[model samples]
Target: MNAPANQIPLQSATVGSDDEIDLFELIAVVWNGRRVLLGLMVTAVTLAAIYVGLTPKLYNASADIYPVNTIQLALISPGFSADAENRATGELSPELLFNTALMKLHSENMAEQFLSTTGAQVNPQGANPQTAKQFLDALSVSKEKSGTRAAINLHGTQPQETATQLKAYLNFVSQAVIVSVSRDLLAALDASIQYIDRSMEQARQQAENKRLDKAAVLAEAADIAAALSIQEPRIDHLAHTEVTPFNDKLYLLGTRALQAELAALQSRKQKDAFIPELRQLEAAKSALLMDAEKVRQHQTSIDAFTLPASILAPTQPAAPKTALILIAAVVIGLIAGLVTVFVRQGIRAYKIRTQSAYMAGYKKEILRREGHYAVL
Candidate 1:
């Protein structure tokens, strides 16, 4: 009386077969959903083309920087020691200096300085902090691996603006470094001069004290010689005095004692002499002052660094490459089309499943009613 027990199982088996899609089924799915796939591809391509057309073209300007040895840039002061020169040389190596300059190109401070100093084509109205950050964002720096040369590249909407910004950025970094080093040297020179002054003052005071002590010793000897009945002018001969029988024993003893005291004082004075040291210090101070002057002169002589002739001029239209954009659009269109095909196939498959289940139930109801009629 009921529908064949196998009917439901057979229908389920058919549904399972439909779900087990193979290459032919996949091809059918795509063919059935061809319209949808076409629509998606057209839409994606159209949107991409519109966006590309609306986007402004960008220009790129690049400048080559040949980093001069930082040591050459800085004038060594007269009193700069060999050790100091070695230290400076290490810090100013071509590689180190190039990296330092490269980093400065990206710094916010350098960006702001560049903006303030020159007429930037992108932000001709003068830039605020936000615009300055944008300026830094638009910059790129690269250094040569084997040489002291570096490169600065900048992007902007205008070719002239791009070039100007690149030049300004390079100038700002060079000036900043020179100014910083010059300031440091000036400070060091001042410190050295102060130290020298202090040393000279101490030496002068010590030498003056020794002379005063010597004078006091001489005065004491004079008084002792007077008490012993020895003449002031005749004290030099006291060391060679001939013992006489008529001479008072006390007088002879006092003369010998005075001679010993005078010798001791002369020796002490010679030992404490700081004159040679003072002269050397004075000469060093003069040399340092000369070096400081030279440094100042060098600061004044700073000119634009010579760069390689290989500097790249700004390209008029550097971005939104047509071929590249078209290629990207094609890739995106293909992806959208594939997605559309699968989605359409899934919807169609779901509807077929619903219709098949509905028919199966209807057939089962009809068969049940016929079985009841036969029983009646």
Candidate 2:
């Protein structure tokens, strides 16, 4: 509003009129002050050019990473037909692109990684707010014409380094930006498969060991039964050897009685009740065998369980795009220029209608004589 040197005030307002702006008159005023206006514009544009040239010529190095889910589009003749599966899988509208871009923008670690790679020194000698704004503003992620893909671009001091670092980080993040229910499911299934394999091996070993022990126990029991049969004949011989003539009749009666009692005891041993102890042992062994089989069967089931899809390693990161950056710079500069013009014009009008400056001297004088000045 303080018209820069030699800018003429083409039209002065009389106190009675509406503040209407005439474009032609305004042009004339500006023409009168064309040197100043042109000088300011030239200065601004020259500075902008200088900044665009000297401040940094950062070339963006970008990583191009496609979503793994979207990788299926590489097919030769993916159905051009309107099938639901095709529709669902193929053109999954960029539902989360905005959120994804925003998340990347707000990502502090990502930003810091970029900052570090670009050798973002804080200018220890001096901290300039305007410089910070320009550099910070340069790091931008924007959507390309292809609605599907996003372009992550960075501006910095060095071209190759900024390009390289930005692409590396952005590419990783882009690939990292995953929308996968299958991935989590696959991981869980893989873990389960591993655990089942370990369990299967253990079950097999245990079943083998139990089978061997059963065979050995059966063999030992047979040997013991044979020894008991041999001992039975010796019991009869010893009873006869211990007898004499005087006690022979007594011995016969005692032997007959003992034999009768032995017969009764042996008859009782032949009953189901007595045999049940051996049956129970056999039942226990059978039960153990059944348990071992079940464990093996469970292991087999685990071995059969398989994951549907495997995760593939990501290729390159998202890339820096020069076209996008230049576009944004042009837009921002124009906006800034427009804003500057309107604001300057408003300020000029405000000052033109300003009566405060004239009254300012009187107000100060009155203030200086606060006790003496009477209100009029």
- State which candidate has the highest lDDT: 1
Please give the CA lDDT of all the candidate structures: 0.65, 0.43
lDDT of 2 by residue, 288-376 (tens): 33433333333212211111232222233232333454555556655565555666777886886576676887898878798566544
Error of 2 at 364 (Å): 31
For model 1, residues 1-376, the per-residue Cα lDDT tens digits are 7888667544554667755659987788778778877787788778878887988777788777775655565554334531212222112244444566667777887777766776452552133333777777777777788666766777776676567656666766767766766677777777777777888888888887766665465556556666867753355555677633234332444545556655665666444254668767777678667877886877645523444444455655777786777778777877888887898777887899899999999999999999999999
Off by over 4 Å in 1: 1-22, 63-67, 77-79, 82-103, 119-121, 124-130, 141-151, 227-229, 232-274, 300-310, 316-325, 349-376
In candidate 1, clashing pairs total 0
Return model 2's CA RMSD, one decimal.
19.6
Model 2: colliding residue pairs: 59-159, 61-163, 62-319, 62-320, 63-317, 63-318, 63-319, 171-317, 171-318
Q: Tell me model 2's lDDT, rounded to 2 decimals.
A: 0.43
- Would you give me the overall lDDT of model 1? 0.65
